[model samples]
Target: MHTDSAAEPRLAGGPATGLVAALDIGGTKIAGALVDDTGRIRVRVQRPTPAREDGETVMRTVEDVLAGLAASPLWPGAGAVGIGSAGPVDAFRGTVSPVNVPGWRGFPLVERVHRATGGRPVTLVGDGVAMTAAEHWLGAARGHDNALCLVVSTGVGGGLVLDGRVHPGPTGNAGHLGHISVDLDGEPCACGGRGCVERLASGPHIARRALENGWRPGPDGDTSAAAVAAAARAGDPVALDSFDRAARALAAGIAATATLVEVDIAVIGGGVAGAGEILFGPLRRHLATYATLSFVRGLTAVPARTGTDAGLLGAAAAARTPRA
Candidate 1:
């Protein structure tokens, strides 16, 4: 829903000539916006995702979001549509199989959206890739020819910008850093892999590790990673240890990414990153130990500047510059 407090988007320099419609689909919400060529969103609408509903029901929500945008006076000006969706997405085939949205397995989202939008051309990319696009275009990764953009929240997701362009791979699932194994012989992951970074660093896992190591929640029963972060700030040993472990795992994965592809910066965002230095401090220290190659030693990690709008903005970016 549009809010009174939401400011109208202004161009950084001057107006752009054409406009595009952008959709950001995720487990929690679906957002739609009409964006100018300058990457400014002029109108927006959103709704909570009916994640547990059948595929048709979820599609209805998406339609409702689009309907809100179509009602705008700017509709006739939008020449194309871009969608950023949770994955694994097959951009080659215009199909998506997002893990969190079971009803959408192998769903032909691009075709469905094209039909709903009265035949406007559509482009699709993974949510991680979308974030990378946004960062590379206007945020922390801007001007960096090679960069890694990450979202560390309930789950860890990432994408790469190589040779000054977003790299979606053939399937739109490249730079999936969360699934990269940092500890080859350690515990198994939900993705059927062992020692995946998400298993050790996701918010739930961080809180779980703290609890297992003897940290207790407050009377409110708030056992979230935020609570653990607070405890760490207060000098709780168990909480600190949990964050440290997560930082080490992230450092290893980041270092490996740097060594393999040679990114200059790693821009991180999402809920867990709100912990501030509790996460970055150790991550930097550990990166010193793991990213040792002469080529990768200067690789740096920084917080993402793009806020909640990254998805919609990135979708708009993809529409303007369709990946080949």
Candidate 2:
């Protein structure tokens, strides 16, 4: 297990009292933390996810991470446990079926975690929703009554904030923008959709498109989207075109979401967002073309400020906020 003790002060408000045990479960890793109400992480632990292993093995990995957190002296003060997991999670049913972790299908994650955490009330939400909560609480989306927060990485994920509250929907997958089809006759997505935003804008797709269009990697043999961003910065036509296409798809999806939800701002995060202006420049330009409707024409996109700790912070926020 890995541990971090960095203390991040809240942007505003007084220091909060009490703590919540937060867990962020993804295909790559399982992270646990003891977070106070003000969004500070007092203690943290993480473990690599044995994603390819059997369900029990994956559960053990999570349990191990939790055990590490529980070993902390502050763990006894944790009043609740919160989990932000990859979709599709059924918060109503307290189950999770993350697409990348095939070993967990309808797993009773809430119950298992509740038992493991000494029966403290356990709350579960999709990773996308969790990120949204973090943004609304302490990042770029703060003070916005309605917003859409996105994570554009290996796969695209998102969540909504409506009327100044994080809205996870009934099953905790409300603002799932990536799966929305952008092309009626384009490539099929692993989510069984045709030409979804994820198929065109995700990091893997960005790199794949660059490679398919003759954008050779550097001598170091880096073919990631970040590498493509570097090539675009160096004025590579193929790399620039790949990012432009991805940005166009993202713009279309963002525009559609704005039209549907009337979100004033869209906060973009995750590894792919690290491309900076390479992605945002084209996305903003394309968004102008698509979001011409009077109400949505003013919609703006901004970078998420929560960084990598969004998942854990969001889970803590969910644990503290009362849900209806």
Candidate 3:
């Protein structure tokens, strides 16, 4: 899924040659697909992500996906493997240490993927970075030269694309918007910070608020952000308030980031972002309140158009970039 470039040979839906294997490894699922060069998925398979399993077991699962892909008729000319994984990753070293998944600390991910796929050149990238890549290539932010993309799912993550190139920064964790502090005295973040954006705007944060406020559905006790969004949609006061808080936090952060970078658009994706207008409406309202920068005044916050396949497509596209 490549975007339109000025005769630079952007690979947008090209002729579908060379089977490129795409893997998206997350806390709850491991999805694999054989995508053609054109970005069309020829064969796709999914397996439950065993977050509790050690790195070795997860590697085995990854290898299992390759075996499944090979059985498809559309997977004959496979030449490379691209992986979109949870952070923090050392893209230069092809390694990862997803804090949520046990035994993933310093896992040699790229080498494992290469070995699993018969020594094919494998590319590894942060999920947030990969999402940004996908959006630039084929999704909502396609033609934008500078944009901030955030994935608000099981966790909050982000990536920055500037001047039409992916910016990995010094350690490949450059665009981690979740780690930024919005409140000096907010809840404790897993990253060991007080009141980071993640603790305020992520799915877990919203759920934690519901738990603390005793908001539930008929004695179910607590609800996820998704459930909370549903309640908010139905005019539930507590749920609506929870969304308001999350949106306000996100808006403040987004506005700050936009002012700092002068990004033209802010693209948001992931499970939690499905809250739609309930979330976006409040976020815009808060942005108006916190951001006074004229350059960022009219920045658009749009939904991600890539869906779930973005990670894989982005990984493959990133793999196409020349490494230093």
Residue-wise C-alpha lDDT for candidate 2, range 17-71, written one tens digit per residue: 6999999999999999999877999999999999999899999999999999989
Residue 88, model 2, lDDT: 91
Flag clash pairs in model 3. none
lDDT of 3 by residue, 1-324 (tens): 111111221222322346678888888888888876667787888888778987788888877877898788766577767788898987767788987787799888877777777777676778998898888878887888888999998778998877776666654666788888899977788899888888888887887787688677646744678888888899988888888988888887788888888888889999889999989998888888887777888888889999988888887666555434
Which candidate achieves the best TM-score against the true structure? 2
After best superposition, candidate 1 residue 207: deviation in angstroms?
Answer: 1.0
Report the error of model 3 at residue 97, Å: 0.9
Order the numbered candidates by TM-score, best leading: 2, 1, 3
Task: For model 1, give the RMSD to the true fold.
Answer: 6.1
Give the Cα lDDT of each candidate.
0.86, 0.88, 0.79
What TM-score should be assigned to candidate 2?
0.94
Per-residue C-alpha lDDT of model 1 across residues 233-276, encoded as one tens digit per residue: 99999999999999999999999999999998999988888898
Listed in order, each prediction's TM-score against the native is: 0.93, 0.94, 0.91
How are the candidates ranked when ordered by lDDT, highest leading?
2, 1, 3
Indicate whether candidate 1 or candidate 2 has the larger TM-score.
2
